[model samples]
Target: LEVATPAVRREAKKNRRLKIVGARGNNLKNVTAEIPLGTFTAVTGVSGGGKSTFLIETLFKAASRRIMGSREHPADHDRIEGLEFLDKVIDIDQSPIGRTPRSNPATYTGAFTPIRDWFAGLPESKARGYQPGRFSFNVKGGRCEACQGDGVIKIEMHFLPDVYVTCDVCHGKRYNRETLDVLFKGKSIADVLDMTVEEGVDFFAAVPGVRDKLETLKQVGLGYIHVGQQATTLSGGEAQRIKLAKELSRKATGKTLYILDEPTTGLHFHDVAKLLEVLHELVDQGNTVVVIEHNLEVIKTADWVLDLGPEGGDGGGELVASGTPEDIIREKRSYTGQFLRELLERRPGGKREAAE
Candidate 1:
C-alpha cells in the first residue's frame, strides 16, 4: 500500500520500531506492520501473500519518497514511522549491475582503479611512461585495437543471433602486447583480472586496498567468481551478492536500512548458510536488514518474524503471526508456523513431543 510523509517520533531507546499503519494496498487487508530497527527481520509467507506489497510497494517506496526525495508514490498506507532512524534505504535485488560485458566485479566494487594504479607504478610501466589509463581496457592506447577492449568480437548474422568469439589478436586478454609486458609479480593486468576472487585475494595480499575489496567478495560467498567476470554472465543471486559485497566494502553507517527480496534464490544449502552469516554481520554492525523470505532456514534464524499469511491470494495478506520463530511455531493458524514446527522439532536435539 501507499503512505505519505510520515510524522517522526523520536525515542530515547536504541531498538526503535518502524511501524506501518493502515497498509491496505492490493490484497493486504489493512495490515499494520511493526519492524524493529537494528535487527534481522523476515517477512515470510506462501507465494502471493503480499510480502512484496507490504515491504517494497509500501515500506520501501514510502521511505524513498520521505528519505531520498524520490517521486515514487507508496502503496495505500496511512503513515510510516521510525524513518528518522534510517539514513539510507537500499533494495538489493538480482538485476544486473551492468548489462554489458565491460562491467565486472572489480569495477563495480571500486577495486579496478587501484589495481590499475598498482600496475602503472611497476618498474616496467615507469620505463615506458605508461600511466593508469594505459592499464585500463576501456581506453585507447594500450587496449587491443581489434576488439575495442571488449576481448571479444561480436558478429551479427541475418537469421541467427549475434556471435561473440574471443579476440584473436589479444586472445581475450583485452590489452596489447606492450601493455601486458608490464607485470607485477609476473602477472599482467589482464592476468590479475582473470583470477578468481580467492586467487586475487592471495595475489594481492600485500595491497590493502585491493585485498580488502576482494576479501569482502569472498566473505559474501563469491570466492570462485572471476575478479573481472562479466556482469552479464552472473546469475540473479550472484548479482545480488555482488551488490551486497559492494555495499559491505563501503564504510558502514549503522543507520542504513537494507531490504532484500528472496536473496536465497538459486543458492545451495551451504551457500545460503554463508549468505546468512554475511547478512547477520551487517545487522551485528548495528544496521537493520529486512528480507522478503520463504526459506525456512533463513526465517528460523531471524530475530523477528512477520508471517503474512494463513493462505495466499484472496485467503491471505493478514498478519498471521509476528514474533520470534519459537513464537511462530505456537501459532496454530499459520501455515508457515506448521512447517517451521517440523523444522524446529527435527533439529538434532529437539524434542519430538514439543513438535506436537
Candidate 2:
C-alpha cells in the first residue's frame, strides 16, 4: 500500500507487521491490509469505517486466538486467510471497571499481597499474632466483619439507581475498625487511597515495590491517582494508563504486538506525549505497538500509516492510502490525504501540526 512513497516505505524493515489476506468480518468486505509493528503507527478512518472491525475484532482477535489455542475452540476461529504473521496481539481496551468502592489499585495490581505479607511477617505482627490475610478485605481472617471490607454500605434504592453510603462503621475505609487501627508509617489504607500518586510517591518512599509501581503510574500521566482510590472512580484515560503501567512494569520484550483502540480518546493534547513515550518504549523493547487512532498527532508520529477509508460506512473499507504523513497528503484518492492537505494549505507556510 505504501508503494508510492519510497522514503516512508524504506523503514519497512523496522516493523513486525500484522499481515492480512481476505479477512472477511464486519464492514471489511474481502479486505486485505498490512499493519506495521513497533514504531508508532496509526490506523485512521471515519467512524463505523471498519477501523475497529479490522484492527480489534478481526486482526487482533485472530492473533490472540492463536495464543489461547485450545481443543474446544471453533474451527475457523484462529485461521485468518492471508493473515500469516505476528507474535502476539494485546487488545488494550478499557473494560468494565472493578467497581464496588472496595476495589482499589493495590488489590488490582496484586501488590497488596506482598505488602500485607511484609507487615504480617513482621516481628511485631508475630507478637500481635496477626496474619497477612487479616489485612485483606477479601479474606475471612482479617476483613471488617460489618460491611465485609467494602468501604460503603449498599443502599438498594427501589425507584432509583442503587446508592452507596460510606460504611458508617469504617467511614468509607474498607478496613475494619481494628484494621484501620494498624498504621504503616502513620498512613492508613484509607489515607493511602486518598493520597494521589503524586502524594503516594513521597508517602510510600520508604516502601519498595508499591512505591515503584506508583511511580510508573505517575509516569503514565496518573499522578492524580491514589493507590487506594476506587477503580470505579477513575477516568477512562486514567484507567487506560494504569492498565498500560501494569504491562509496562513487566519490562515486556520481544516480538509482542500491542493493538490499542483510540488510546488517546479522552486525553488532552499534551497528554498524548505520555502515550507516545509509552509506545516508543514498547518498540525499543522489541515489541510491536499498533493503534487505531483518529488523533493526528499519533498518526503523524507513526513510522507507517494504514489509513482505511476513502469515506465512512458503506463507502469505506478500501485501503485508500498508507504511508507517512508526507506520502498520504500527496495521494489524491485518500480522503485523509485531502483533509490533511487542506489543513496544511490553510496554515501558515503549510506548517500545521497534528495537535492543532
Off by over 4 Å in 1: 1-15, 157-162, 346-356
Model 1, 64-85: lDDT tens digits are 8899889998999999999999
User: Where does the lowest 10-residue lDDT sum fall in candidate 2?
Assistant: 1-10
Q: Please, what is the TM-score per model?
A: 0.92, 0.85
Q: Clashes in model 1: which pairs? A: 1-75, 1-76, 2-74, 2-75, 2-76, 2-77
The residue pairs found clashing in candidate 2 are 38-288, 134-142, 193-228
Score each candidate by Cα lDDT.
Answer: 0.86, 0.68
lDDT of 2: 0.68
RMSD per candidate (Å) reads 6.9, 5.4
TM-score of 1: 0.92
* Highest-TM-score candidate: 1
